[model samples]
Target: MDLMAMIENAMTSPVIYLAILALATLDAFLPFLPSESVVIAAAVFAVSGIPSLPLIIVLAALGAFVGDHIGYLIGRLLRERRPGGRLIRAADRIAPHLHRRGGALIIAGRFVPGGRTAIVTASGATGYPLTRFTFFTAIAAVTWAGYSGLIGYLGGVAFESNSSLGLVVGLGLALSITALGELVRYVSRRRAAATGAG
Candidate 1:
């Protein structure tokens, strides 16, 4: 079945929420799954009163956190094995920038497609302290869940009210997230350059 149809089916069942959470967590490590659609669909269901919004948000965040931590652990393991493992070596070019604007990079990474995995992996490879990593990771997960959920909820609201408005809003939210990712990258690069020069 197509994505929308799959989402619709899942939404109709009680297992949809759990599945979404699991998928999102796995997506963090795998980096190829469609976690965004799952979250969006859950939000749509929540807005339609099929599930509670708070629960949706909480579960989504939990899943994201779990996935991120798993990725981090993998990185840590690699680091422990070799100071300059494959993961660290690949991320080295951006490590300096990531370290400088760590918080912003983490947050922006959550919004960027395929970024969640990269951030978590990079965080691990960089040897960011566990405490600091968890703190910033939570922030990123919450922001991602909130932004995606809100957009999906708004889409549901528009579906109930006006289709045109819902379409516009959904598109706008997607575009804004993409733009924010670009901005974050730009800022990080500039910061890294300055730090290197100094």
Candidate 2:
């Protein structure tokens, strides 16, 4: 079937919660999955009373945190073995800025595609102190989960009110995600340039 029908079917499925948790985990590490869609679907399912809002939030947060930690460990291991690895080298350039403005970066990164993964990798590659990384990452995880969940919940409400509402809200969210990604890229490039110039 088409995308909307598939989503509607998934929303009613008994295994949707499991699928959502899995999606959240994969999305965190893979960086390419449409994770936002998964979370929104979970919220939509919540409207049907299959998955509770609190449960969705908890599962989403746990899955995201675990996935990020895994990514971080991978980055650390890779950097330890190959200090000059391309990814590590790029991460190294931003390590200092990450160190200085980690909290803000982590929070903002949550909204940008590929940013959460990049931040986790940079944290490990840069050897950021574990305690600090954990503290900030926890904050970011909570913020990200809550924000995404809220969007999904809102989407569900809109879908319930009117079919056109879903389309409008989904399109708006998509645009917001794209704009945020572009903004993050611009900021990163500017920071890199300034660091070079200085």
By TM-score, the best candidate is 2
lDDT of 1 by residue, 62-160 (tens): 888889999989877777787766667887777897788887778777877778778888888887677878898899888877777788788768775
- TM-score, model 2 to reference: 0.83
Provide the overall lDDT of each model, using Cα atoms, as 2-decimal numbers: 0.77, 0.76
Model 2 residue 166 CA deviation (Å) reads: 2.3
Q: Estimated TM-score per prediction?
A: 0.79, 0.83
Q: Provide the lowest-lDDT 10-residue window in model 2.
A: 162-171
Once fitted onto the true fold, the runs of candidate 1 whose alpha carbons sit more than 4 angstroms away are 1-7, 161-172, 183-198
Off by over 4 Å in 2: 1-3, 161-168, 177-181, 184-198
lDDT of 2 at 190: 100
Clashes of each: 0, 0
Q: Write the per-residue lDDT of candidate 2 for residues 20-139, one digit (tens) a residue.
A: 677777875788886667666667556657667777777777777777777778779979899988999999899999999987887677677788889888888898877887777777
Q: Which candidate number has the best lDDT?
A: 1
